[model samples]
Structure formats: C-alpha cells, structure tokens
Target: MTLSFFDQFMSPVLMGIPLMFLALTLPWALFAKPSPRVLNSRMVALQTWSIMGFVKQIFQPLSTPAHKWAMILTSVMMFIITMNLLGLLPYTFTPTTQLSLNLGLAVPLWLATVILGMRNQPTHALGHLLPEGTPPLLIPLLIIIETISLFIRPLALGVRLTANLTAGHLLIQLISTAAFTLISIMPTVAFLTGLLLFLLTFLEVAVAMIQAYVFVLLLSLYLQENV
Candidate 1:
C-alpha cells in the first residue's frame, strides 16, 4: 500500500461527502436531542399555522426560545463530533471534515450578525465593523483588515475544519495502508503501525470537540459583539 505522490493525494478526497453519518441521521429524531426553545413572533406564527409543523416540531412540547436554540446548537456539535469520530473508522464519512459543511454552519452566523446589527441600529451596523479605540489616523488600515477578516470568518471556519480533518485522515490512512500492505510480508513489524491508527482516531475525537467548541464559542462572541 505504498502510494506514489498521486495516490497520496487521491483516496479520501474521492469521498468528499460523509455518507454514513447522514444515513444514521435519517430517522432524525433518534439522533436528535429535542429540548425547549423560545418561540419568536415569526416562529409563533408558523407554529400556529404551518402545515409541516416546521416551526415547533423540532422543539420540545413546552420549550422556550433559549431551550430550542440550545438544543439545536448542541445537536449540531454532537453531529459534527460524531461524524468526525466515525470518519476515523476504517470506512466512514465525516461531514464536519468537509469545507462545504463547515461553511454552511459558519456563514449563517455571519449573516445573522449583519441582520441583528441592522435591525438593532439600522444606521450604525456598518460603523461597528471598525475598531472602537483606534486613533483616527490608523482608522483606514484597521477598518480594512478587520472588515475583511470579519467577512472571512466563515471561510476560515470552513478551511480550519477541512484542513485539519483532511490532514489527520490522510496521515492515518497512509500509515494504516502502509502497515496493511506490509503486514503479510512482515507480520510482526506492521502490527504496531496498524495499532497506532486506532490510538490516533481516539485522539481525533477530542480534536473534533475542540474544533466544534472553538467555532461555536467564536460565534457566540461575535454575536455578542455585534448585537
């Protein structure tokens, strides 16, 4: 299983999507942790009238708004961490390991910040994008970088997950593949190599939680800052 440079780049990239985790989520409620969430006016209206029960169905029977949001976000963190752990298995999909999926989670927070700021103070949201304590002379450069970075957080979110997970998966896969290939030729020597993959996978679950926590924590901080 010694791969050339080309093979090194090819294997898991072919499986960009995480199929197994998505399949496991099919009976969504089994994987879902339902809880109380507050009903905003818009959601209240939907709960009262929507045919699909889209508004309140995911929520617990007597949930408040915070309960529901808490459930939703916690479920997402679990989903990502679970998926990442699953991917570490011999053959499984890691949804959070994808750039697209991570961006899907991050971009909405960015959009929400914009909407929250605008709604709170229609004329002032854009102004809040710049640093508050900077000197007037340094204002332009600070504004440019901060604004650009603000916009790029979602992209950073995506890249951060994609890069780290992809690198870990690639390294582990390469190591295991090498061991598997040589195990027949040199049984005793490759056993340790094969075992290392499992140890690393166990370690990766922690990495998954850390990354998810970092994403959500930054999101909460950003929301607090803007809104």
Candidate 2:
C-alpha cells in the first residue's frame, strides 16, 4: 500500500495506544536536573544560562507587571521549540502541526491576556476597541472591525503555526521522494536533489525554532497590551 505524503502527520500508536502523550512529555525528561552543589554540571549550567537569556530577551520590552509571566512564557517556548525540533526527526509526528492542538494552546492563553486586561483595566481594554480620534461616522464600523480583529488573534496564532510547519514538512517529504525516485535513473541529478534536500532540512530546523519563538512572542505582545 502506498502511503500518502500527509500520512507523516498522523499520530503514531503502539498496540492501539496513542504515542502523542509520550511525545509531548518526553522533552521535559531530556533536560538535566539541577544539582544541590554550588556549581551545577555543565549540562545543567548550560540549560540555566540559555533559559535566563531567552526569558530576558522576550520580556525586555514589557513592564514589571508582565515579569510575573516569565516562568510560564519561558517554559512554553522551551516546550514548543523542543517539540518542533523533535518533530523534524524521522518517523516522528508533530503535534503542533494540528490545528486542534495549536488552538488548544492558543485560545486559553490569548483569552487569559484579554480577561486580565478586562479585569484589571476595564476602561483601557475596552478603549482599544475604538480609537480616541475616530470620526463620528466611522466609529461604529471601526469598533466592529477592531472587535473582530481582537477575536481573530488566537485563530491567527494557531493557523499561522499549523500552516508553516505543515507546509515545510510536506515540502521536505516531496523533495526527498523525488530524490529517492531519481537515484537509479539519474545519479547526478539525484545527488543534486539530495543536496537541495539537505539544505532544506537546515532551513526547516531554523523555521521550527523561529515559529516556536514567534508563537510565544505574539502571546507576549498580546499580554503586553493587556498589562
């Protein structure tokens, strides 16, 4: 039976049990646990330093109130980046490529930011729906438009991630197949295609990391507006 290119996205199973949970939880265990000693092992120290740097850069533009989310946001970025990079490996499924998973992640977080804004600064949050200098004729239309945009933020977040990863994975599969098929017929052409595939793999690696960062960064921007 010929497998479809899209089959790669399917969650794998072992004896009828889904492995998605295992994939999701596996990344956390891969990290080094901190030691009680004054100096950590190299792995632990490197992990700590990288995390600190990531958090600082993400929160650089935000006010003190937003610093409270440093742990949550940083943890999310780490989780997502790990999952994305791991998905690029052979025979692995990418959970983030699914709209349901992405939406599950995005909606609650985006809603939290909006709800926080509504709770702590009701007027300021509501005011975002309408500009201060709106013309009398355009006020209603502008408010409607802004409201739609506000609600669409989460959907955009989920779709943007799902689409980017899905497209990249599909392209990789297609190119690799072409290279494999050409191997016996035209060795030189197949070699060139294989080289192209190698370069694309590196590009996808960068994309995986960037998409994860962009996902977190957009959420932080949403939070910035609220807090």
Candidate 3:
C-alpha cells in the first residue's frame, strides 16, 4: 500500500469512530491539578508559576474590562499548546492542522470580541471603519475596505495556524522519509540526513509551541482592541 504525504493531516478512525474527540480530550488529562498543600510538588509549582507568568503577560496591556476574559484566553492557550505538542509524537493526529477545526475555534472568539465591542461601545467600534480627517470622497472606499478587513480577521487567524502546523509536519515527515530511504544506499549520507532530521524535529517542537503562543497572542490583541 502506498501512503500519501497528506495522509498525516487526516483525522484517524477506528471501527467507524473518529479519533479527533479523543485527541481533544486527552490533553486535559495530562494537566497538573493544583494541590491544597502549603508546598506542592516541584512540577505543580512550576506549572503554577508558568501559568501565572503567561496570564500576566497577556493581560498586562488590556484594560480592567478585558481581565474578565483571562480564564477563557488562558484555557485556549493551554489547549492549543497541548494539542500542538501532542501531535509531534509518533502516531498522533494534529487537530489544529485542519482548516475547519481552526476556523471553528477562531470565528466564534473573533465574533464575540467584535460583538462585545459593538454592544458596549457602538460609536467606537463603528469609528474604526473611518479614520479621522479622511477625504469625503475616500470615505465610502475606506469604509468598504475596512469592513472587508474586519471580516477577514477570523479567516486569517484560522489559515495562519493551519498553514504553520501543516507545513511543519509535512516537512518533518518528508525529511525523515528521505533519511530512511538513504540508509542502505549510502551510509555516510544517511547519517548526515539523520542528523538533519534530528535538528528538524527539535525545530518543529519549537514551532509547535511558538505557533500556539502566536495564535493566542493575536486573539488577545483582538480582544484588547475590543475591550
């Protein structure tokens, strides 16, 4: 049987049951729960400290009104990070690589921010469509352009995440396959390729984490503009 490179992006199935649900739920189980003890284990302590730092960094620039979204944003950050990292393991599927899944996550959050802004401060939200001191002739054109850009935000968010993860995974798979194929044909070349593959894998790990952070950071910026 011949396998296609794109096969890696497809959600797996077993006995007619899709595994995406399992992939989504498994990451929550790996999270460390806080202990009530005065001194928790080192792992829990580190996790707490890291999470606090992330929250602080994300919310620092936003007004008090935006702070209420801290929990939702934080949970999303953790979820994306976990899913991205998990997908790097052998035989694991990456849900974020799917455009549909990414769009599903991005649209509602982006729409909510937009809706919140419109509801709370309609004047300000609508004002964004027109810049101060614009020529009367350009008003219609600018408003049309701005409106299009506003709606494109969610699509851009989803595509950015899907493209990054999909590209990284595809590259890793291609390079590893090349390394394996060269092993018997040329030992020295194969060894060099293998070393390159190792480096690529490490880089992919970083990419996975960074992409997750970027996704969350952009969403927070959107929220900041709204709140």
Per-model lDDT: 0.63, 0.94, 0.91
**Tens-place lDDT digits, model 1, residues 144-227:** 887897788889877887888877877777787889898999987788888887798777777876776676556555555454
Clash count (model 1, backbone only): 8
C-alpha displacement of 6 in model 3, angstroms? 0.5
Q: For model 3, how does the per-residue alpha-carbon lDDT over 176-210 read when each residue is reduced to its tens digit?
A: 88988999999899899889889988898898888
Pairs with backbone N, CA or C atoms under 3 Å apart (clashes), candidate 1: 36-63, 36-67, 36-68, 37-64, 37-65, 37-68, 38-64, 38-65
Best-to-worst order by lDDT is 2, 3, 1
Give the clash count for model 2. Answer: 0
Query: Which stretches of candidate 2 lie above 4 Å from their native place?
Result: none
Task: Give the clashing residue pairs of candidate 3, or none.
Answer: none
Better of 2 and 3 by lDDT: 2
TM-score, predicted candidate 1 vs. hidden true structure: 0.67
TM-score of each: 0.67, 0.97, 0.97
Q: In angstroms, give how far residue 147 of model 3 lies from its true place.
A: 0.7
The model with the greater lDDT, 1 or 2, is 2
